[model samples]
Target: MYAYYGKEKIRMQPLHLLMERGHSCKLADIVKKCLRLDLLEKVTMKKNSALMMVVLLLMAVVLTGCASDDNQAATRTITDMAGNTVEIPASPQKIATMTGPSYEMVFMLGGKDKIGLVRSDHATGYPLALLTNSDLPNYPTIKGVGPQTPVNAEQFLDAGVDLVLYYNNAAELEKFKMAGIPAVVVNTTTTVPTTTEEYFEQSSANLKLLSEILGGEAVERYEKWYAYLTKNVELIAERTKDIKEEDRPVVYWGNTWGTNILSSYSRGTRDFEMELCGGTLVAPQEGGQFPEINKEQLLEWNPDIIFVDNHGNAPELVIEDMYSNKNWESLSAVQNKQLYRIPSGVFFMDKGSTNTLVLLWTAKVLHPDLFADIDMIKELQYYYSTFYDYDLSEEEAQKILEGWVDAENLVR
Candidate 1:
């Protein structure tokens, strides 16, 4: 057979002859036999062009996938106190504290600028937070989902919070997760430590985790604060370890909760604090953490000293009421005027970072002669300056020790 291509005439090869010649024909040879071209030659050019397009597409897809992976790598995973694995921004810029105390904790870690939201009652609960950080009150506040408040996921999402420090609440955590917010449960009612050692261990772990999340100077800050806390704990332990059981005065931590004068802390941190400071806890462990006892029970215990909670009523007013109330007149704490207001700044001294200072203060109150050398005022000054970067005047330090709030600066 023969064929004409434009002006040239080409001879066609017989199928049997082409097959017998070779299965592998060169490009020039295949083009020359245009009239006898096989199906393979017809599709070969199209197939190579299609494959090149596919290769370019695959390369584009792979490069795009790697970019996506790099974006995902921006976050890091951490296990919170509740043992939930949470992926959060490696360096979170906007932090929301759902718990009242966590605001102070984050603030101490030098994350003041990173705070975007705070608990509704944080201002009132922690007055010094507002006083020290002028911008604290400017952040949006939300009521946490708990026994008292309902969950509102929209509020968290609207705030653009990158990270949330919350109390252990599974429902709240789920809500936050659904809103695409990273939440960490740092505290739980069920995990309250019964001993000072356990409390310190948990507190130290929490501090370390928080420091890791915040990064930067926060790590060094946690180390310094923890060292100070450990040194003070060891000092107190060394001094009080030798005290005889009989010599340890019976101490009670009293609180006025919503017109109830009999409210007191039993077998929790308060009890441990009393034990560490060489004082006997007047409240028995069986009554629960915060128990309400009758006036008769108070008289029976006859606690040698009382540390009043400044959360509810002012410590001064609580002490004044206890002194005037005829039912409390016979109590040793009232009769001897041994009631002292628990010092609080940013948060209660009985809890949080200030608890270390409370250990020294309680020791001084219990055994003046033993801890007389420990200057609490200087300690407070140093703590505020070092941790919070706030230079507390001597007068302000004394006010905090006296459980006096800065009512003028307090967020209403």
Candidate 2:
């Protein structure tokens, strides 16, 4: 703080004061009573609107004195993914997030210090919390919690969380709103990112928007993630550009463990992944986003390649079902052993900043020549270490490539 006594402006440490009732007054009146008339008379002033406005506002503030930083909090408004207009702290010190893809994004963008707590849904643990050096599990937990879960207002307040990053928790979000606690919906990843292009666009948009709330180091992390995504996407595109749809291999993918209830990506993000990887997704023509086709339909399609989502909590069971089922033996993908699984980690490689890695992995499996020289494990090491600050062991990288997780070692 600076004050004018007579001629020179002297710097003064601000003394915190409680705002008195009716302390605020009109601008002209404040300038008349508060400011040193001699200082104003001697000082040269700017005539611009911006400078004049600042001068007036500062003058008013000067007269009113000041309050603690907490009493004069800085904030801004943003429309969240759920279309809720929320005002959040300009620089949030403590944050709470639902653990999964959203929490993973928060950890990558901003480190774990600001993250004071986590809300768990299924599996009762956060992927990063279980796997990383951040000791995520040590943070207090609102365990087995979600939208329908009871809103524990006292728990949040006690944890000192001023900002919250949520996904699929409408009930809790409403509670926070009513309590005047600022919570922003961050759907960093879900089943939404289906195609490579959509993946980049959605992930970039998420990072850019979230960084504005997290601020500081988050922006730098986003730049790194975006640049890496662009380079990988372009490399894949350039190599597979000339391939035609009919020439591509037939592909099928399932998020779950069993093949009994067969599912595949339609004309959505998953379909684009097939195209991006130089393959064609084969599924029922008319059912829905995730059309469940039967054995007869699977026999008809006889997909040349199959990709399983290993991050969906049951990869081992899913892979076992695929290999042991007699009905699957007749398929081209199974006979040729072209079956591959999606990478798993803090967030599935299919979404968030890891989406480009999915494209790279899928392309490598579908068209080996395109990514012949690529070291997928090496890439994973760099990405994980740089973004999350978590070291990726070569052994673990191999498992990620194979879409396998030693669940007992990582998750409780």
Best by TM-score: 1
TM-scores of the models, in the order given:
0.78, 0.74
List RMSD in Å for every model shown: 17.8, 12.0
Cα deviation in Å at residue 161, candidate 1? 0.6
Best lDDT among the predictions, by candidate number: 1
Candidate 2 stretches greater than 4 Å from native: 1-73, 120-131, 147-154, 168-171, 188-199, 257-267, 283-293, 404-412
Worst 10 residues of 2 by lDDT: 13-22
lDDT (CA) for every model shown? 0.72, 0.66
lDDT per residue for candidate 2 within 1-412, as digits (tens), equals 3444465554322122112211223233435644566645654433445434645765657455434433555566888776778887666666777635666677788656777677643123334436664466567666655545667766776566667777647777877766445788766334456556676776577667777777788888888888987888778878887998777888888655343336654555666666767888775555654567677877887888877775445666766776888977898887888777778766666766677778888888888886798889898899888987879899988867766554443332
Supply the global lDDT for candidate 2.
Answer: 0.66
Q: Alpha-carbon error at 101 in model 2, in Å?
A: 0.7
Error of 1 at 10 (Å): 71
